[model samples]
Target: MTETTPLNDIIASRIARQGRITFADFMAACLYEPGLGYYTSPGRKVGAEGDFYTSITVHASYGRVVAREIAQMWRNMGSPAGFTLVECGAGNGRLACDIMDFLAEREPVMHQSLRLVLVEQEPSLESAQREMLAVHIDSLSWLSPDEFASGSFTFSGCLYSNELIDALPTHRVVMTSDGLKEVYVTCTNGEYAEEAGEPSTPELEAYLKRVAVELHPGQQAEVNLNAPKWLASAARALQRGFILTIDYGYTAHELYTPLRKLGTLLCYYRHQTEENPYLRLGLQDITSHVDFTTLMEYGEELGLQNAWFGEQYRFLMSAGIIEELEDLERSDVSDEEKLRLRLTLKKLIVPQGGMGDTFRVLIQSKRVTAPRLLCQRRIGG
Candidate 1:
């Protein structure tokens, strides 16, 4: 290809030697291959200047809403003397800062007991996380993905991730007339291309069966083996507490419906959706929709109760966004600034072609007795 970067060349050379590489491997390299990958590069990945905006980039209100839930979680755990809050995929720690700020201000007791462990793959981001979390440094620590997944880092508190699972490399497969075949990356005319072949593992088929989804002929889908592995590790590491996950996704049936022939994998660059992941190499961010059903099912298997799973808007509204809005009215800022904040916050929960409906929140708990949460509030409450 004309735009062959270092990572691209590395990936190309590997594929040339191996004949073909699973989309997962290609994607893993594209997004996380040391210095050359997308997330490993030195540039902004979120907010107005970056590729795309997650709910955290919208406003501090989102994390504040989450902090409200975390406070409830602390109460649910009977005001534990010690609690660990591990945030995976904690990019730059902005959300963590917001949560820490809210806890210090509104839930001093919990804040005092809180131990926030920021687990991120990119070691370089720790500086940014440290800078952003300067106020809560004593309550914070860092953990590499390998260290977190090592099965020795057990804790009793909440582990959360926002839009993390969707970034894990996934195996792409299609139901063909012959059978299920994986879509592997190959070189064609000096450019990356796809080639269908037999799946590398039986788990691909088992994953579909576990979800009870049978793709239509020629329909391609992604199987995130990493998701279950991640969940299993999280379940093991969490001796007792909750796993809160927020991402854009669907239930198994909804995600693997017959209509989606090309699967949900997508690339983002400069706020635009790019269908071609082959073009940008490490420049574009690659992601897919999470499957909440699998998370629920697997959580149950791992002894974690499916506490709550629903659209982000419902979770936000039921949790505490309205109260946040009410607090805005009492702030010293002018009404014009308040209005701007309101509009920006609306993006966090606005449905119908917005972040609200597409993104989902899932909260699963382990060894928590009959517990009540703020999101359990009735619609009118």
Candidate 2:
């Protein structure tokens, strides 16, 4: 018999009271149910101590490269006097600190006028973010997800997130003989199990339709209705500027292919991947591959132009990774440290068995005219 966790009991009680609930709701509870969730009651959720390593954890150069692009974005917007940089899922503020460090050192003018608004769902993490971003405390601010989407808070700058959409509670669906059905969580004899049922909303079907995706019979997939909804709120908040999203995912064609029958849903615990989300309850990280097609299509409808979209390697290379490397080479660090750093940085750009091709960067702009951003530059030229 499987040992039940505190969260497992909490969830089971809810199921007993509510009968059955959509998988999305179950996932939402497992991940964001106030204090007991994996992220909410966090204990070093990122880096070597945590379940996984983000691009931010790999090296500082990745953030430096991203900072270069933001600097260009400010320039593209005619160097606005008050440019707001909002990071939606700013975990520990490492990326924000790195980006801010680069901007302060290189683009002092822009840094001087910059206001960084960190929109995080977990309130406990604000303290860690505050400490991590201590140097830039004067330029920092905070916003709840509700406040950000409330339509009262608008900004004229770039908004970005890393691996955020995938973590948003997503509805699971499977193609059936009759049509499509959503996966629901039900409790029987105090044990949780999955069952197929009518979709919680019509938007699930409409989402696939918007992306022109057709699931093969017996194929399971995740529909992140929240992704588009979040993008819509982000679009409303951004009066003029860019939305930079970095995540591991594919276009609709690749994401919904017949070969990927099991879907991209997976869990992480202490660096090990678990196929069963039910195993760890709220102790593990639950995520799925984002569908970039929906973000692009929905972004277009929101009046944002798709400025650039491609592999992370391309974005890093074209947006000043090489310059960062050159600077590293000229630094006073020992040859041994330089060699180690060089190999570490390769993980960010290598395609096979690395973050390069699997992770993608999408830049969507609103009211920005023919912006020639740094990431759009040719690799060699």
Top model number, lDDT = 2
Residue 265 of model 1: what lDDT? 92
The lDDT for every candidate, in the order shown, is: 0.92, 0.93
Name the lDDT of candidate 2: 0.93
Q: What count of clashes does model 1 give?
A: 0
TM-score result, candidate 2: 0.99
For each candidate in turn, give its C-alpha RMSD to the true structure in angstroms. Answer: 0.9, 0.8
| Per-residue C-alpha lDDT of model 1 across residues 117-187, encoded as one tens digit per residue | 99998999999999999989999899999999999899998999999999999999989999999999998
Summing lDDT over every window of 10 consecutive residues in candidate 1, give the lowest-scoring window. Answer: 1-10
What's the residue-level lDDT of 15 in candidate 2?
Answer: 88
Off by over 4 Å in 1: none
**Candidate 2, pairs of clashing residues:** none
Candidate 1, residue 126: CA error in Å?
A: 0.4
